[model samples]
Target: MRWQKQPVHYPYEHVVCYDLETITDQEMQDGSFPPWPRHRPVAGSFLTAEWSPVGYRFKLDTLLCREGREAEFYRKVDSLLPPGGMGVSLNGRNFDNAVLRLQAQRNGLFDLRNIARQAESSRFDVAHLDLLDVFGARPGTSLAELCRALSIPVKTSVTGGDVADLWRSGNVAAVKAYVQEDVIATYILHLHAAAWREGHERQLVLPLADLAIWLEGEPGLRHLLSFATCRPARWARSRAPALRAAAALAEAELRLKREQDEAAFSAR
Candidate 1:
């Protein structure tokens, strides 16, 4: 919780890792997979790490999916994604993003905002980090497989295929819990990549406190407080003092940028 602020300078504001759960049907089983976007999204969730007193913490959310509520669910998802921040997912380019677009179309909504643009980019683009593309377009390997490859823990008691049965059985809580698990696993994978970038070659569990320290002078912490959009609850009450200090520094820096830009415009 106490580290000298190093020269932090990450490219994006934050890294949000997400995934969607869809309802399946017999056609999916028959491999007669219709043009439908990889099962109708019954639920979606995202997880983004933040600087918390508890070390590096995460803000997690689940967007419940329903027939008439698809658009609303997407809106909630959009609200979490800040511009210039990165979105992370496994096979999201082909499956999850398409699901969002198709549902948005059905609901008479097309303004997907950031997600829409991310979907349009090449998977290698930083707009959205598709792990499948990160590892040489190994499309056949599942996210779980990729996690195993990285030696990161993979926890999922239920598969996406099982979601439809659980929904039909009316076990809504189970489905929600499952979706959260998927997103959390994805978040961990993102962390693994970050560690690797910092020259960590061995697989190891990342400590929450270490996350804060690791991001301390790095680019990851730079944008933690600089985005124009407000990030609610970046830090818990337990860490209010630290959060306030970071916010103050960010505000001053932002003000300086605005003044510099205005002066440049005037001179021009």
Candidate 2:
């Protein structure tokens, strides 16, 4: 795992793309959809990508707390989403962030609550970026649907609606797999959004290629290796490293601005 080192100043140090799976009943006694607070989180998954010397490298992690370990599950997810890194997700601000905050408050996990709060903001330095919001936050579009429109590779073995039934039938592996697939899709979306924001189109292919290549070695995620084949030609792959530097540099600029503001306030 080596590349000819390039002078790449990545803007952000790292990015964590995450998704949550909860077990809400099919319907209440009154036959209504489950309320928001009742969506008990059973599985959490995140893909963390950090800037390396050559480009960004990723690690995929997941947790299942289906029986009764919701607190532990949230804690593990929180540990990866430390402040000062980008937290990217799809439809997270409305659903996932609220669920995580409410559950963390109930479990006395104040740090997790605060992280969830900060992650819901529109600020650049905040840990959260909702792809739905990024892509106009329009009505009727979903992560899978949007990925299809953008031609990003998306796996659809299961849907969030199937999670509860799978868990109930003792198919916990299926639930975990579904959550992981969503997180990976979210990660792929974030890469495109970042590249587009930074105006570095070629930058998109490398991190994705890197992710697909990394998935090859991950026993639990080998099913997603199809993403590896979606990479562009050799020429595009060769130029991608040079293009990724812009997003990294943009983050550096933001950091510098924050420091300058703090220094001015201290001088007064």
Candidate 3:
């Protein structure tokens, strides 16, 4: 029988995992310090909220980066993510975020640069968690390897090198699927890595009581899996009573356990 994998230590309850598929690098013959983004088309992208209540469920979606609409595509993504919370990916710091910033120079995203700043920092930086950078910077460490190592399925049929060919062949849909799979795999890889580092205690640690707060919508990580319990829109706020009652129940349960322990001790 196969051994079960443990859950990772996810300190941040909120995160956004994303992956970008783009055309070949826009080469600048002159190797300048600030390499501006060239006219390369952003193939497409996918992102998930990484937050689910009492289960592994999440909501992930994709967006196509059509011709002449690079800025619009990038803007929607940038705005989709809120100010804080870590962004997880494989080599996102050096590659994905770099491409995003270069392309987003003309867009009006408020915190677009924050991804660059946080993602490029040390591993301890929670703002952005680039698995490649955190994992000893081993040269040529691809996503497929990490996924396989962690027992997560590498869902895509093609690799990054094949994106341009797929696009050329009118398989833009395939490219989107590929990129979306990468996003999902990245998130799974993170859970494994976190489990490796912090060890898993329980699955779907996010409490149902926090459902209202979670639905209230903080940007980034986990946007997959379907569950009717999570259907309520973010606009429908939860009253303090719901949150407090849950807390009160928990506190009472803990108190009862404590009392039982004390009574047994006294009898001894």
Candidate 4:
């Protein structure tokens, strides 16, 4: 059976939903329980597919391995992704990307310096759209808080902290389930955001009853919100300006501190 083709040009309409699970050695070294001390320096990472629109599909060309699979993972991801396709993630730029790049270097997998140079030269084709950045940068919002505020159902599965324990305990199945749920939640949120963007609507403030009714009979449809939830006016009224002003102040402070440190070092 042929599926309807999604518009390639409309990025907001076509989203690739994904989630990553990472176990940091630093967290382990902090005297955390269970997997911490035993699994020291063994950071297990997993990437899973949550959902993809009709046109796009999840491509897991690389498999995580004990001997460090950074090179393999990078190659597979590069091969699977389309040129210029946006890399969607919960907070990919800040967390996932940083960790992946660091791991890649530690494992001697790839030359990120070259990648940065290529990006500077406009030789890089892929763009990234981070949901965490969007939601966090959104006035007065956190992930769980945003979902609650938006009336999107939150998936209460195992948290990231639980992942390391699960892996160390040899419970691979549980870990997969947890990772899958995370991916699904991320995908659902991404879709809701995308729909809002395409429709030029803002703020999600639908009644729970109405949303459930709208989601009925649709598989994996529980993630989407109803029209009643879109209330841009409420959020815009207060949060927008506060976020902007705060960001401006933060930027100014950073700049001033950097200049002061530079001048002090020069004088010395």
Which structure among the candidates has the greatest TM-score? Answer: 2
Measured by TM-score, how close is model 4 to the native structure?
0.52
Highest lDDT: give the candidate number: 2
Relative to the unseen true structure, what is the Cα RMSD of model 1? 11.7
Q: Give a tens-digit lDDT track for model 2, residues 86-133.
A: 777787777787888888888888877446654466534356777787
Ranking by TM-score: 2, 1, 3, 4
- lDDT for residue 59 in candidate 1, whole number 0-100: 66
Q: What C-alpha lDDT do the candidate models reach, one value each?
A: 0.64, 0.73, 0.59, 0.46
| lDDT agreement of model 2 with the native | 0.73
Candidate 1, residues 1-268, lDDT tens digits: the string is 8888564333333677888888655454566545545467888877776543344555667778776777788788777764677888888888888777777777787787876866776746767878776566565577778666654444446776678889888888878877776675666566556555555422112333333344344553333222111121122223445545776799899999999999999999
User: How do these models rank on lDDT, best leading?
Assistant: 2, 1, 3, 4
* Worst-scoring 10-residue span by lDDT in model 4: 201-210
User: In model 1, which runs have C-alpha deviations exceeding 4 angstroms?
Assistant: 1-13, 29-38, 51-55, 198-268
Clashing residue pairs in candidate 2 (N, C-alpha, C atoms within 3 angstroms): 10-248, 11-248, 11-249, 87-127
Tell me how far the alpha carbon of residue 63 in candidate 1 is from the true structure, in angstroms, after superposition: 1.7
How many steric clashes between backbone atoms does each model show? Answer: 2, 4, 20, 3
